[model samples]
Target: MPYQQHTAKKMARPTGNVRWMVVGLCFLGMVINYIDRANLGVALPGMAHDLSLTPFEQGLALSAFFYAYAAFQFFGGGLADKFGPRAMYTFSSLWWGALTAATAFASSMLSLFGVRFLLGAGEAGAYPSCATAVGRWFPKHERALATAIYDNGSRVGGALSLPLVILIVETMGWRESFIITGILGLLFAVLWIKFYRDPRLHPTLNAEELTYIEQGGARPIDPATEEKISWLSLFKFRAVWGLMLGSFSLNFIAYFFITWMPSYLINELHFSLVKVGFVGMLPPLTAVFGGLFGGWLGDHLVRRGVSLSVARKIVICIGMLAGSSIALAVFVPSGAWAMALLCLSYSGIAFCASNSGSLCLDIAPTGRHVAAIMGIQNGSANLAGIIMPVVVGLLVGNENNFSHALMLIGVFGFIGAFSFIVIVGKIAPLTRAKRVKVADAGANNEITH
Candidate 1:
């Protein structure tokens, strides 16, 4: 189906903001997704004592989730692309939710690891589905902000988990915490199934808004005519590698916050459980605004006629550089000073994350492959999730000093900055013509400009 064109004057009339509602759902899904995943980190202290786990064992259990999560990302993306976001989201949410509830039954290290791994597999479909949905619903100029809105859920959920999970763990026990979050996910799946539809099929979306979306570059869902790109073939593109490497580096540092921040507060800084619940929330909470600002700034730049490539790169580089402040925390003497630096570091990570997600949509071969590409990058990035916890666990060691770990995360921030600034080239869709050229030339050669 062809897009309906409308003049600027006609477009000025009320077109409705149904697209915002779609993004709102994406946001809620992400919030639940993070809450389920991050709950373990907060509950780990009590859980470790209850199960008689070593620090290494705790790290192993934490890393276990990423093993399946990273492995399934590509597969999940393909499923999202093939089945549509609505089905993928509903299926993934239900699967993860059930697994989260099942975590309550884990009585041993092996069982906990097994449950967390399955939960990872179920949660892997989330962001890819969100990326696919955003590509189909929002125009280019608005994509970054849309990405930010949903991605902010990670920060929100992470922040909320500190206090919420702590309260649940204190009141009802850690097992009950998992059950409550699990039920929340199950409920969201029902809402998603009932309300989410493609722009073309949405009963409430006005024609004017649809036309505005299409004209501004929102992809209209039409699978019959969509081009199918080979999944393996994506590796031939230099930009794809750049995205993978860049994302991997970013996640290397970011995962430290997800898996170890609470531990760092409790063990290294010697904070009480009550203080951990309140103070631990600061960095991620600050990150929430950083992500929103980054998203808004990127979109604002595009609307002011900045090239997409330049606009995105500038934000990404700045964010990564800012995130390098994590290292500075190690040199600080006071806990307040250390928290300030950590907060800055997390804010910078969130700032870059919004645009990093947008890049998947920006460089996809077509709307059909957005989720697949997202899966590829996210799959690679999540390897950090598997590595960071174990690495931090070892570095913290018997003495429980986190200085080495902080320095390592800070260095990776610089590496991530370099990857985005130097490795990633111009931002544009990789068309079929380019794909065919790479195929003809052999995957050994980089994609032609």
Candidate 2:
């Protein structure tokens, strides 16, 4: 592809820092997206008390969102691929915002479950769209940083919710917190639809910036994927499955912190709601640093002449080793000391996670497929999300010992490390097949057409 020549030839372009502006917008969207989702965990504890639910039932409520969330991952990606990032993002944000508000109106366990399921389904498209958008707007070199900047929202939102949602629950009540957060998402959705577009189509994007992006390896939109690859062909590559497996390990650990950690502190450790909320802020705070450091380090390694494949894997493995701290932290008795260890554990998790989105873009065959690939990975990971909460709930079932669940989480981190090192051979785009066969329908379409 004459990427440089084509991009350089464009006359009208958007002005300075608009690419970074796009990254900034996505970052705020991520923060808002997470705060809406993460608040449910904080709210669940209170909702359980009022509803007179068992731990098992509350676990069901916790897991319900993931059911829809996991199921929609592939669908969301397809939507992003077909519709473009702007429209899909706008729709998802608006839909989830509406569902978040609907959550406040639930009167029974079934109602809450339905609302959560809908909410998860609504939000499932968000990250995949973000992944697709990043692939479009930024070059390959800056993807990790852009991903970290936005992905940091998972931690920032979680960290912010620690104080924000819990204090709202402590004061005005849990229902109102949903109403407030939902409104924020609605507002962001409007802003996003108004400002965002594919870089090739972006009216404000300048020629110099566009050329710079393409020169740095930004992928142009591809219509070729429509003929080049089939849904089954995606499975022909091992990278996709490795990503799916690794994401499962990561999400299993993440949901533990996001959905259950607050309950763990309150129920087992006997901490006050306010106290737990404040301390809960710690892990996400440290995770912010992890996201930043991981992005910069990964990018730095690539710039220093290291292979992108090796750099991503090395970064991922080191992060998992650090993340394995969860197993040891389970044994610590002191609340403050345990908080310290949890912080380290989450930082490592974020550090490793900072690369996951980049990996999705790295392997995407074209700009259009970025979200779809991400969705496959996300959906697979969230499949575990659907299972782990219930698994942990069953494991804890009226017991104070979280050691078993905690160890399971730590073990998953190691599994993820192994998958990246051994299973996912190289971080590169999926190349279309060259051999022409009667059965090679995908290639045959390209050849015959």
Instruction: Quote each prediction's TM-score.
Output: 0.95, 0.92
lDDT of each: 0.88, 0.82
Model 1 Cα shift for residue 216 (angstroms): 0.7
Q: Which ten residues in a row have the lowest lDDT in candidate 2?
A: 2-11
The root-mean-square deviation over C-alpha atoms between each candidate and the true structure, in angstroms, is: 2.6, 4.6
**Which candidate leads in TM-score?**
1
Per lDDT, the best of the predicted structures is 1
Question: Any runs in candidate 2 off by more than 4 Å, and if so which?
Answer: 1-15, 224-227, 434-449
* Cα lDDT of model 1 by residue, 371-439, tens digit: 999999999999999999999999988788999999988998888888877776778777677667756
Q: Which RMSD does model 2 reach against the true structure?
A: 4.6
